[model samples]
Every structure is written in C-alpha cells, then in structure tokens.
Target: NGFKLKEGRFKLDIRKKFFTLRVVRYWNRLPREVVAAPSLEAFKARLDEALGNLV
Candidate 1:
C-alpha cells in the first residue's frame, strides 16, 4: 500500500527570508523533496515545479 500523507504550512525564517517546514521526518514518504526558498513568491514557483515533476 501507498502512504497516507499530509502537508503542513511552510514556516518562515524571518532573518533569511526563507521558508522552513513543520514536518521533517516524513521526507521519504513524499515524492518531491522541499528546497528552501528566499521568498514566498520564489517558494510558490519552486512548489509548482515540484508538483509538476510528480507523476
């Protein structure tokens, strides 16, 4: 059977303008691994790319 997954919000690192995650241990269950982004807009763009790469 496949995994039952959930995605939480991206928590911001205010000093660096980058985003972090709520869940860290479930990376292996995910098809796309997250990359830290410099801004919200950049994060969205990269998120779209990650989703697009998913089969």
Candidate 2:
C-alpha cells in the first residue's frame, strides 16, 4: 500500500489479504473519511497507516 498527493487530493492504495482498496480523501475533509474493517484493531491500524502516509 502507498499514498501520494495528486492534483489536489490525497490518493491512497491500501491492500490487505491480497485485496487492494483505492481511496481518495481530501486533506481538508479528512474528518469525514469513512473506513470499514472487519475488526476494530484492523480498522484502526489501516486508518492510521493510510492517514500516516498522507501526512
């Protein structure tokens, strides 16, 4: 998984268990980002990693 700034938004490529999910969330509206995961730990880890890369 990787992230980069493109155009004017943060582009994220997150993968787990062989599946990849692409997400585009604006930096200004990060608080509104919704991420669904199978477990609380997974959700937190993924979200942290994704947001970490953006920063």
Best-fitting candidate, measured by TM-score? Answer: 1
Flag clash pairs in model 1. Answer: none
Error of 2 at 42 (Å): 0.3
Kindly state the number of residue pairs that clash in model 1: 0
Q: State how far residue 52 of model 1 sits from its true place (Å).
A: 0.3
Cα lDDT tens digits for candidate 2, 29-53: 3343324456788768877877787
Give the Å error, residue 50, model 1: 0.4
lDDT of 2: 0.46
Give the poorly placed runs of model 1, Cα more than 4 Å off: 1-34
Residue pairs that clash (backbone atoms under 3 angstroms), model 2: none
Each prediction's TM-score against the native? 0.38, 0.37
lDDT of each: 0.50, 0.46
Error of 2 at 20 (Å): 29
Q: What is the lDDT of residue 47 in candidate 2?
A: 72
Q: What is the lDDT, from 0 to 100, of the residue 38 in candidate 2? A: 61
Query: What is the TM-score of candidate 2?
Result: 0.37
